[model samples]
Target: MAYFTNFKMMMLFTLFTLTSNAVFATEVPETNKSNKPIPEATKFVTQHKGTFNGKNLNYKVVAGETYLLDKNEQPTASIFSFDYLVGDEKNNRPVTFIWNGGPGSSSNWLHMGGYGPKRVVVPSDAAHPGTAPYELQEAPETILDITDMVFVDPVGTGYSRALGETESKAFWGLNEDASSIADFIAQWLTKENRWNAPIFLLGESYGTTRAAAVSKVLMDKHLINVNGIIFVSQALDYQGSSPYVDDNIVSYITYIPTMAATAWYHQKVDTSGSFEAFIDASRQFAVDELLPALFKGNTLSTAERARIVEGLQRYTGLSKQYIERVDLRINAFRFAKELLREDGIAIGLLDGRYKIDERDDVSADPKTDAAKVISPAYKAALMHYMRTDLNIQWQRKYLNPSDPALSSNWRWRTAPDGVSWEPKYVNTAPDLSYALRSNPQLKVMVASGYYDMVTPFFDAEYTLNRHGINAEKIDYYYYEGGHMMYVHEPARVSLLTDTRNFIKEQLAQNSEK
Candidate 1:
């Protein structure tokens, strides 16, 4: 009986070995989904004449789909972009790739309300722009004459989407997003034969974070080094900007100047001098006094604490009682609500200049942001423009801000291995640092809105000043508007001029090199 059992065991072992070897040898043909032939990219080109920067220019607008391929060279997604080209295609005109941030936003904000040739007309003074018969007008302040612009909508935003068997969630993470955008950029350059053109990246809000990471990816993966980067409402570091969390000492320090500016704006603070001087004083107070007091925690002396409280009240316009109750660490959200609470209004986070009358005046945070009031106008303008002017006919629904599902599922992981990811504060300043170091000639222009409480201008200074960045290569531009500074006409023109000059200067510098 033992001999028979031994024979059966040997036979079974041999059978298992043969089956495993056969399975391994079959060479599963790289999954049919990944090996399938990809469809050709869809491109629609139209010509139009427009006057920008006092130049009567004839340009070609290319509204198209660029397919992002998987490792097997199979199409995985269709990324949409609106490319505006001026001058002869033969000449190497500098190209700027622009996108808005939300991690979920479409490029429509920048396209319809910003540097695009046509802009959606909203009230320029940060008023509550009522439901529109939204007027669209020629944006003569556009940078088209100096550089060709391509407004990109990342996968799952606008008309861009995951194709074939690929899931939309695959491109929703930090590292994955940067990699995909970098791939799209490389593909765009290759397809358009614009590899010789000086490439510039312009990103707003969270898009700034993407820009920093993608710059590194472009250099490391494709050996494509960008000439310059423009950060609109820069938010590379969250630790400095997030003011709601407890024990966030950096937030207390960074938000002081912005609060002072807001208070000055609302006349909550008595300031007779220049706004610059007032802001400078607030900065000085934050660094010299507020920062130290916050760091002292529970060990702070009565006199020192009292002095810091007085400084907070003087800068933020909050009463001494409120400051004392909050232990001198005033939350930005609460400040936004409480600053105007007596008047039954709440200030906007995006643009402190805008005010909202919340249903609950006693709420801890503002119910809504006034900057979002103009979103409807932007959405309407972009859809109408795309269909009428660009003549883009698509079955897919155009997502204005983004697909809700994508935003909900967005992975905030900053690192691939997930070991060093900060769940609370997403900081890509180090990525920008690496990129700056990798390409020393790479210039960066930071555009900030004085009234933008979301990504405070002071935070931008804090993030950029560190990381050993070359100060000479960095340029700072400020505007009197909110996060989308271009919404204001004067700011729009000024930012365009600054951008055009920056690009020109960088190109000239690169040529000399």
Candidate 2:
């Protein structure tokens, strides 16, 4: 699928597509004919037996597309999903719909690296996945015994695309994306005749954002309630997670603990005390001391400012002089570069433990994420699995990371174009709150990585601790890895264990009700 921003190219492509092949339209008028004669939804199914969580079972893998239709029953989009079904017990079995996050991302990351039956083997020690011929190992720890899984790829990703006169941008906005996925879920349930099954949502990164919004959409629009939601590296509130903006006061406070953890991992800070104790102290300092000092700004006393700077230095392992120069505010990306600057290395934002020697040592931030070294192996493994194991013979390219066109044309507004509205950080925490209130039985599990600078563990706490979200309904789990914490083997096992237990607990409660 492709989108042409240039008028001449769009005209040329339109002519070419009309005569030769069809083009996937993005932001095109309803009158556009480029996407005419949409092809049939694709499908490939296979069966296998696998052991998960000590239970051996036979399962069917349905690698297929589910087309979503409009109000008039016209095909609007084709969402590709990989469904792993253990048995035909639809009424009793729980179904967990999963996806990874980039506003434009496919489900490949979580599919090939985290919860799928097979995963690409990368170093668990935070080292780069060196080369190809990477091992694809069985991930028997995934919670297949307790629940079925569906990994979905939204429009313009994987083999999914806009159909007929529908513009790809129709599914690219925050609300649009969530609504489409909700529609897909409804369609999926009806198609599989599994509408009565208990449903769960598991999402990572922006997928977490989507999950919250999707939950609200499901309850309000579809009149369907999800049993639980699992947020892997929760990013519900962007204010806390975004460390790029200079004046984001919440971010300065939210990232302190993650920075402390990173400092401890790199041996940049004192390791004399217990790590957990130190993290707790860092959190305290952030809220109690640092938050006040940053808020006071020019009114802060010199002595108090000095004291806060000392605390920042102690927690972040940056020098007092450097902390003062930055006015006590440290951007996460800058910290990644400055932490090991003397060693001519830059750490990753996704996983602070991963480091790389960059050619440009003077840059303010890393040229690229050090943790992304495992991506190629993941993509390769998924492709191989699809072809060999699932018997998939599709020619369409799978947008693993995400499609460039989707990213470029993504809409972030909650309102339609031309609507008068003030812009704010993208947040779906309120939507989550609404869902929880509407569905009193609903619960959430937040899984965080100590070293994830992108969506700091502390940020998750800050975001979820308020906005009328009940504290007791949420369960928190911490890991020793980074953004994609499952990349670390121990974290992977622990995460699976936690997720499995969470699902089982939810089911137990469902039975009681």
Candidate 3:
């Protein structure tokens, strides 16, 4: 769940190996038709009524599998999606396609915790959500009243999987994953007869990376134009988010504000001033002071290095010795463990507010994410809701994160095999820039959490602000919680309100055209 840790490093390493070897399997596997006939794509349709934003509306929930085909029109994979559409008005209303990240994730996190009509209740105060029987409450705050929703679980996650003959690894690469999602969107639009409706892409974490790439694919390949995109905890450029890597100067700079925010949350830093002001100062210090000192490396003078170390200490609340020990570049994971080390507690990387007392306080980084305290509740709620509420009776097991093979086989190479390419951070911000350039009317809303160490708010700023993206078309919204900011009540309400308004604003602009 954290950045470029072992799994991510393996992904990167695999890409490097593939590129260096300059070899790939050029043959697409034969269509999988075994001794037993492939089961028909399963689907469950249910009708329900609810009050959303004070408006009583009846909606249909279509939870099922959509087969993705090869160029020969043979089924290659099945993508499972949950479609929520207003009664009979599915074609006319705006539609937003949503997914969570993991590169191998199910859409369940955003589905159950953020935008779903029925959200699983967890402790908003960052406490453990305790055992099961988790409450499923009506999320009237969701923006469903204005837009039809499609929550997609990419292949290898949820009930989605590779069909006969096609291997799951076929959809486990950077380009492969985005292409499948784009294909699914086109297929969904065709099935629902909603090609004319305003389309939006909403993705969180690595899903944000998918959104940007998908937007470009939709425009360049499908001739489809998205009206807007919402990036929840954006990770379009991995360089800014990959803090675990050594000598990654961008990460050192990008993570300062987040560390400052975490320190402020734990009251490790001086908190007398406005939190916003402190964050602003941290951002400035990162760019103006720390970045240059880190860049100077061994050339930096002792006096200047000392001043920079003091600034880091002031913002990060880490001691001078620790700052010097790490050579003034703080690894975010260590910060999470060190911030509350004396108290025998480690703060959560996903949400700094959550703290756990680990058995081995000696570890440099937390063994597990403390913020994952709510995961069990979310998992239970989704499984229960699918069967009981959505009537999804399919026997297939739902993979929450993904299949083990997905991560192992995941490819990150950007170029075709044997193209003489070098490994680099996986970035899709340029794709988003291309999409914006192609569709002049398209705008983006970036929602970032102050406490999200996984994808820092400052990194979001660092990413979108560059990449030739138009600042005027990009709107930024900040939240109080971490990666899944909606877990915080106030943040959840504000996120939905901001989302609702952003969609409306985009639609309004469409009308004037």
Each candidate's clash count? 0, 0, 2
lDDT score for residue 262 of model 3: 87
Per-model TM-score, in order, reads 0.91, 0.93, 0.94
For model 2, the local distance difference test gives 0.84
* Residue-wise C-alpha lDDT for candidate 2, range 273-386, written one tens digit per residue: 999999999999999999989899999999999899899999999998889899999988799999999999999877899999999999888777787777778778888888
lDDT tens digits, residue span 281-354, model 3: 99999999999898999999999998998999999999999999999989887888999998999988888899
Q: Give the alpha carbon lDDT tens digit for every residue of 218-246 in model 1.
A: 99999999999999999898888777678
lDDT of each: 0.81, 0.84, 0.85
Worst 10 residues of 3 by lDDT: 13-22
lDDT of 2 at 204: 92
Question: In model 2, what is the error at residue 252, expressed in angstroms?
Answer: 0.7
Candidate 3 local lDDT, residue 255: 94
